[model samples]
Target: MRIGDYKVSYGADEAVFRTGTVRVWMIVLFLAMAVFPFWAGDYLLYMANLTGIAIVAAVGLNILTGAAGQISLGHAAFVGIGAYTSAILITKLGLPFIICLPLSGLSAALFGVIVGAPSMRMKGLYLCIATLAAQVIFEYLFKNWESLTGGIRGINVPAPTIFGFEFNNEFRFYFITVPVVIIVVTAARNLFRTRVGRAFIAIRDRDFSAQLMGINLFRYKLYAFALSSFLAGVAGCLWVNFIKIVTPEHFPLHESIRYLAMIIVGGLGSVLGSIFGAIFMTIIPEVLKSMLNIVSAFSPDAMAYLSPLQTVVFGLLIVVFLVFEPHGLAEMWRRVKDYFRLWPFEH
Candidate 1:
């Protein structure tokens, strides 16, 4: 079979199960995830939780920026809204964590719709500036809204409970988070096949042309924003519960940048890229810290220099990846796999 410029073999034309290898890999991956919490230690489990949360947020950002071609400097703000809303509901309103979590996401979605309304008339840097303004406004609200957000003091988030079972430890949280990550990623993957998703892609490729083709740019853009915010909110809610805190410091502007970096470094517009990007970005710091610790063990005097070196290394990694491998780690992985699979048969 052939589609567009690519040739498709017997298994490649299938919509869901494209190939036997993919199906097997999916099953193996699912099995590994199911058993990971039981075997992993506290530190690994903690990292997994962080990766899961990042994946969710990155997926949302990919939908907005990758599929819709909207630049959002306020992605973290929606996450903050989700966290703060859930925290307040749990701490003040005495609601169940599960109930409040979804509500928090809903609240963020509503706010996203409001923010996106202005985006209908804005484009390019102007739209980015608008989103940045919302981010600043949200930060101010989180900092000054003492009655709800607890001001700069922050608020404690209780451990999540599902049907009387509490996810109080890293292991338990890992189980909860991993499944949610899988579900969210799968949903995001399938979304791109739907009409709204196609509209988003169309708008992304050429908004004016998409509009000329009868696509409702305003409605679809608003939908994209709401969907993106909802996912971000869900991630934020999970993060708050995972960390057991809701602080303004947690949703800093740098975090928004980090999320963008995750998508860019993972592969924009790809679900697999989002997941891999989250995992790589989240774990790389820990890996670096371990390496630094080992170096310090050999020379205690070098400990103070490690932090700066780590920062420099991280920046360099980003720059190098952008300049040489802008398609990101996933793309690199794909190319490497293809090279090996085809062996001496060069395309």
Candidate 2:
């Protein structure tokens, strides 16, 4: 809200951009994003694309676990399904990447329903275990299905082209991801405003209570799973296209845990938090690697400890956030904004 902004009507009170200032800022932000490719280096562009993909996946996980209060450790498997589905269709069936992207998401959503079937009878830790087991089963299938997935060999994806324009470099490809991310993020931000989104939140808060209020526990639970998995699937499709390769080993349990850590660190129930978490999780390793390289160069003995040190730093970052800031970085961000807004005020 602007400093002197006031809602004159109910619609104004509920609007996304309540003030003209925020909308102007948003326009400026998009304008800057539009020109980022021209000014940024290849590495920065790569990170931007990578972060965008992770944001998509993190937001999906946040929807299931954060908004719906459903625990899923099998999220990576859904993403893997998306990647493989898109890759197989593109490679084997000669389908365009654009068409395969949503189709891949739908494929994963189908599996999401199957996996969510256990949710009707399970909750909390039991449900977490069920999803965790699903990951194992999914991974086994990914690894064992040698013919389709290429097994340990992996499959390559050709660079996508649209209307005679090839997205061969990160700069050009940023157009594809930036728009998709914007759309996904915008949809996610608006989703909670709708009845179905409210139903998901109600189920998350207390499924039994939600059921008493006429919300179908089974149906909404599966809906949450399908929606969440579809987002993850889209992320997976983006990953395969960006990386230009699909491997069974790419989606592992640690990756799933990493996405969970991201949402938790970013703030579970916030859309912006997903983007924050994805950026932090993706960039930190690169930051740690850079620091470690300097240390290892000065002392070769430190080379042996590089991997474990980075792991320790990552674990510590999560532990610090969980222990002292359970609400995550989004809460921290709000406090900063509040402080700025209330500057010069007296207690």
Candidate 3:
């Protein structure tokens, strides 16, 4: 039977993979991911790539809203900014994907700082409305700025390449998406162990007390926004290139809400939760569609009524999770692990 937990050093306590079993499982997980695209079909690989992108974006949102307690309703607009920036860099300046990727993130981070400036004076719903305003403004710019953003026409992106090795297919793109997801998740996991990340948590818990402890709330809040937007930008760059298009319609207000839902359904302030939530949110809808198709095989008229129920079912699932388990899927997963770890014993 497993006994108690122990750590002799601070480093050991703070380690990401604290036990051998966890490390082995992580290794197995990585191996599976590495082998996934090789055996998966084209559609499955596309979904995998999309899931990786969602994980990156959800983690970013979780960092800001969940960890830092900074609410945002303009996240999708920032994503659009990143997508457009990468597209413009590649199409107008003839920059390569490698150069445009970081540049896209930097551009979004700049705007994120500008949008986040009001956080020095605002909080709660007031701040949310401000972000909503930003969303409207950016959307307007995307639609009306013909000379720059293509004015509703959108930009078509070419596949990314490294040293002339073009990632022109879903199989090749899978390599890029998976590695980026891993790097982003690892960085986010490590971030919470740092001083700045602690500062974010402090701000989230109690800004007044955080200030009493000499933490500059504004600086750290801005840092949270910058980092969050940077990751979103990276996701956007990958998304634009993967889809081979950039459009204003892709990043809407509902899209921001969807990202918010991801963190909430996954678990607030948890890195692993972000992954769970992203996968859940991204895959569940597709699963529902498949189920609907199965039902339709028996009843030709089923889709007419069932089509609208898909949204209702999704909303109901979120409600059920919220009402029964407020801590989210991540908490449920933790409970499962704890139960298995202490098998034949109950605390």
What are the models' TM-scores? 0.93, 0.97, 0.97
Q: How many steric overlaps does candidate 1 have?
A: 0
Per-residue accuracy of model 2 over 1-347 as CA lDDT, tens digit each: 22788778999999988878779989999999998989999999999999999999999999999999999999999999999999999999989878988998999999999999999999899999999999999999889999999997788999987777888889988999999999999999999999888999999888889999999999999999999999989999988999999888999998899899999999988998998999999999888778878988889777677679878987998899999998898999988877766776723
What tens digits encode model 3's per-residue C-alpha lDDT throughout 166-283? 9999999998999889999999999999999999999999999999999998999999999999988888898999999998899988888888888888999999999999999998
Give me the displacement of residue 48 in model 1, in angstroms: 0.5
Q: How does residue 296 of candidate 1 score in lDDT?
A: 84
Candidate lDDT values, in order? 0.87, 0.91, 0.90
Top candidate (lDDT): 2
Query: Residue 100's C-alpha lDDT in candidate 3?
Result: 88
TM-score of 2: 0.97
Q: Which stretches of candidate 1 lie over 4 Å from their true place?
A: 1-14
**Model 1: per-residue Cα lDDT over 68-180, one tens digit each:** 99989999999999999888888888798779768988999999999999977898899999999999999999999898899999999778888999999998888778877
What order do you get sorting by lDDT, best first? Answer: 2, 3, 1
Provide the global lDDT of candidate 3 against the true structure: 0.90
